[model samples]
Target: MKNFKILNNYSIRSKLIIIYLFCVLIPMIVTNSIVYITIKSNEVREQRITMEHAIERVKYNLSSVLDDCVLVSNHLHNDITLNDFITRRYDNLLDYYERYNYLLQNNVINYYYNSQHVYQVTIYTDNDTISNSSNFRKLTSETRQSEWYRQFYNNNEDMTISVYYDDNRKNYGINNTARTISITRKLDNFDKTHENILKIDVDYNVILNDILNEKMEDNLYVCNKSYILFSNKKSNVGTEEFDTIDSIEEKDVKLNDFFRFKVANEAWNIIITANEVSPLSKIVERKEILFGLAIFNLLLPTIIIILVSHSIGYRVTLLGIYLGKVENEEFSTIEYNDGQDEIGKLIRSYNLMVLRIKELIEVVFKRDAEKQRLELAKKQAELKALQSQVNPHFMFNTLESIRMRSLIKGESETAEIIENLSALLRKTINWGEDYITIEDEMLFVENYLQIQKYRFGEKLTFSFYVMGDCKGIRIPKLSILSFVENACVHGIEEVSHNASINVSIFKYDSRLFIEISDTGSGMEEDQLNLIRDKLRNAEIDMLNNSKSTGVLNTYMRLQMYCNNNMQFEIDSKPKEGTDVTIQIFLDEPGVSNSFVKENQNNNF
Candidate 1:
């Protein structure tokens, strides 16, 4: 009873009221401002989107109407009874012609001359002018002469885009105030006895009504090339929608790119405005209630909250440390406790997440590069072994030739072969990164050509031109040299000195292009096909060999470093020449000019 008296003091009530005012008022001001701004932004975005979609819907409606008009015109354009109606003689074709006009007037057009049913078409012939219909009839009709008419006449009476004050206005005089968008196209030439122009006057109101008077609970307006066609503002039709009738600005909004264009392609625009107070008013009410509740119940809840804050001081400190680490994005370690309290469980879960993140960082970022380095070392060794075998084979083969020549009546032409072979062997065993400057690689090819020239004697000739800016560019080991060796082995066996090799490297438009041409027995289509199949299957062996062993290992290494869009082109003709084109993108992806990850810390 004494503690209750202490808790019920005026000082405690005043403190609680101050706490409530500070806490609730700050949050209310902030929350209300934030809520107000967020809702306004979203409303703007949603209104813009809805406006764009509404404009599209309007265009679609207009386009559909135009399509219906075209369908009717196309049918009448090929009509058979049209010729009889234009001749102004209702013979055996009156019923057929009346039916034609009826089909045209499905819901839109209702005009004819010598048309038995509705409004009349007036025409002036060389002899007389006449128009006769059920509701509207004329006897001495003056020729329909106007600038609009002559434009159609000179255009072979094809079509004129015009609007009408009324769909029922067939000629010069009509009292109706309503209007329509229409097209008029001639069915045949004026000289012939055939149907003249087919006139289409469609009601544009139905289309405008659907979008302009939409029940969106938002105001929508639509504009055309000439005027604001309609709006929900209770303005009259044909009222221009915007004061700025400039071209439809691409409002930087995401829009669907489908254009169901209306005839004459009168591009339309839309603007949307939604009611603002509806959404935000609720937020305002919520803030008021929360603030009022905080005021009324202020004292008791505050005393209880203060007691809890003092009791949980240590736990709050621990949470603050953990939150600091999280803000720094360093989750190397975390604290855990065995207790089943909410705070204990939270710390335990957080520690588990930190361990999982460490493992994922290892897997996601580091594994691929480690695997590549190991595979690269293995391939280099394997290729070196294979390259070692080549030297001995060529040595034995050349010695055998020299012995054969010496046994006969030779002047030691084999001496030249021995020297060329020695130079080729030394260059081919490049013991470094699979890359070398173009200058170094060309020297290797020169030695290869010397060997080939010795073996084939005067039967083979070689010419190489390393062109502008291509001299010192780095390429994979043996790229051109290997091709020279291949040509020596395959092409020069049959032809004479005309059987040539030309190594030309020219840098063009920031790319490295190599053309290796040989003039011996060029490959057949079948052989080229076989080679392409082999090249396509080049990656399959590496993918299949889990051990990552290979011949042409340098080739595979270069390919791995190239972009996916890198290319090789082979052109050949039987007995002419074979041109092997290798196009290397200098800025190829995954193949940086400088070592980007060179200084990556050894984070063991």
Candidate 2:
């Protein structure tokens, strides 16, 4: 419990490192150690078993060679022709040679050709009839006392097998040298009276090659009870003695770290020494590599834990700082990173709480100030309404008095002008209404042109072409009239020649297009561009400063009322004319339905 409390006091990074070391690294090391030890134990047992089997295999192959030699000797000893050749007495030496040649061809050569390992087969006899021939020789006292001969004679068994070095060039006049394993047996007549010797020499190198080919890394020694007969190591063949065994029949004996096994029917033992390092030494050699791998395994998890813990802890610390700010009543919102994890959600929720709190506090603190602002706005609106109400009424009444006076004085043209001015004033006052129909706007434009025509006399001529159903298509009030006024003052008035103004309204699909053209003094390129730039930027102050307020004001008002759904453009050239176009998209259901109804009524 105390350790747990201590761990809790540390940061998350340290805690993660400690936990990974105990939970992941320690267990992995323990498991690997157990597995390595188990594998080493199995390897040692397998190595020992493998060496014992090798020794047995060698023993079997050597026994096979010795058995073949014994079989050949037995066959030779029982041959009647060989026994006759050995015992028969002949008078002439030449006659004895002929008989010996016959025996050599039919008996000795046949045996030699039949056996794969037998290098030669020979017979030695004490008889005076048998001369030394290719296959037989007289048995001398010196030959009978030779080491191999004595060994065979002293055995007293039917046959004896031993390995000795023989030169075929000196013994049988063959072109070969071999370490040979010889099998010797005593031969007797059919009556079992006298005896001769039959010997079969087998190529020991051939037998050993077949048996010991696979055990190149091991040392094999074939030894009898007294001395080593043949060995893979040539230096030890004649000099090495058989190590004393506690039991002659010991199957597999471990002596001086070498394994020894005895041949089945012979006194010989096959000693095998494996050319392999001890298991413990191998483990020690690879200890550094294992340690390095273990360290890398532990370090990999440590790094990953450190990185993850740092990320989480950093985000949490940032959240804490934001919370502290809130506690101090700063009420600032954190810049949300838009992460979708738990921390992101927490930050978003905290920002929402701060916004709600800010809104509540604003309401509580600024309530009285907001009320005063509203009261002031109300008074200003009333004053504007009073000014709007009294001015238009006074202007209308004055214009009516002037029209009556002119009619009474027989000035009917002047009276008609006064009436047109009063109508324009009334339309201008009604501009406070947000929207007016195309027909109402067109009527206002006509009234405006009448006043201009009266002023210009015969110099100003105008035409209106209202194409398609344009009656109830609602647009911002004063949108069309402002451009009409511009055409009169700038386009028509400046040209000295008689000028014409054309106002065209047409509907194409769901949009209404209006064009106002005047054949008057148009602007230069630079002046036209300047006016265009000012209107495009909705620079009302700049336009008023430059005495081009009407078009700029109309453009801004159209933008404000139409949410910029209307298109406005002005095209002009010096002394030719000016064309101003306004395109209004009629996509709203209220406006479209009103226009459709108005069109139906007109058609009916």
Candidate 3:
């Protein structure tokens, strides 16, 4: 309930955004994702099923071809003429040829010669009288050593399927050494005097082509335990030595699914494996349609929601902004001509309230301002009257006459003191200018210090130094002089020994630094702290509560002169000395004379 209340506090725009996200965006994304995943899963399953069916087709084609060779072998095994001819010993080559030619014409193997699947048929016997020929050969010691002969002779089965390389065929100038697949059987159907065997070499290319005719996307391997007999890949069928089943699998790492069946009493395998196909390839085909649907489902609804929400929320938000301005005392009317809704009525009511309050403020504010203006004028007249009491022209003329008389009396030191006093009075009494160059201010300070030097005699010493281009930089009039006056009055008056005051001015890092150090009776820690605190938090109101108004007044004036962009520091040790440092940023305005003058008069 609390969460719902907080949600209700949200603006109409926020609520609409939430609706777009959950109702439109999320459902659309989830629907598309489920569709994509279903399509991918089906594609993978179909690929697997297709590969399995292809393997079955390849196995059937392979079995059919081998069955043909098995049939041919069966006929030869049962043939009494083939059995009798090999068993009979031949007396000579001419007589053997006559018998061979006659048998060849009447042989059952002659029928298989024109068959496309059968390559050759040969009979081997141990009869020493029978010469080696194309169709019949006498088994020698080397023939006994051959792989196929040994397997057949040792096997207990009457018939066996074998795939082996016939290196002896290479001598027939058949330079292509294709591996041979043959069905070999012992011809013991009729008891014969000599041991006879019949072998049928099937056309390897014909079986391979049959497998290829299936046009399976996968590689197909037909293999026995000992060797791979044939493959859809023609190159795999023609090795001088048949490759092991393990070797074929190593080359075709993807060949995993296999079917095992007997071929002529020997176990054979048909392996089917597919090439890799990218899963995304099928998904990409439907992406454009899915994208279009998503735009219709999510984007279209989102755009509608935003437009409707903006129509409602925009005025509400604008009214809220105007309300905020009113909270800040900015009584302004709304410029938008909104509808006659509840919020529009509230705006109209607020505008009426603002107009009434503004009218009341104008009436009261003007009356009070007129009263303050009259009071300020009276204060200014009284201040000008007090300032008129001190006739600077008369004082200057008198000082000039005294200095000329001292010069005639040959009192050079007195004349110099009088001249310094006159210059100090002129600079101090001038109220028209609040700013003076560092050179003029330093000159005024020098004149004041000369008078102090005359008064203190040898007990006081002073030095003023200005460095860099700071001499022409402008500053508030008497900004440094007040602090110098305080240093002399409080720092030197109580000291017994010779005291020296030093003032140095310089500019660095675009800031003007004015430092004054005096070797005199410094204040105690408590007094120094009080003076430092007063300088830190100096304000026009402090002049009423503090006795050290001179230094505090100068500090505040300089602060206002520099737009409050200046720092002041005073370090003093009792019975040791005092140092006052002022750092002023040269970038700040220092020409606002009326600001300081008005505040100063108000304090007075």
Model 1 residue 389 CA deviation in Å? 16
For model 2, the local distance difference test gives 0.70
- Candidate number achieving the greatest lDDT relative to the actual structure: 3
Compared with the true structure, what per-residue lDDT tens digits does model 2 show for residues 50-123? 76776677667766766676677767777788788788888898888788678657755475547677777778
- Candidate 1 per-residue lDDT, tens place, 460-485, comes to 88998997456666666777777777
Q: What is candidate 3's local distance difference test score?
A: 0.75
| TM-score of every model versus the real structure | 0.40, 0.38, 0.41
Q: What lDDT does the true structure give each of the candidates?
A: 0.57, 0.70, 0.75
Best candidate, TM-score-wise?
3
Stretches of candidate 1 exceeding 4 Å from the true structure: 1-184, 187-189, 193-412, 456-460, 488-499, 519-567, 572-577, 585-604
Error of 2 at 561 (Å): 6.2
* Better-scoring candidate (TM-score), 1 or 3: 3
What is the Å distance of residue 281 in model 3 from its true position?
1.8
Compare candidates 2 and 3 on TM-score and give the better one: 3
Show the colliding residue pairs in model 1: 112-121, 186-197, 228-240, 228-241
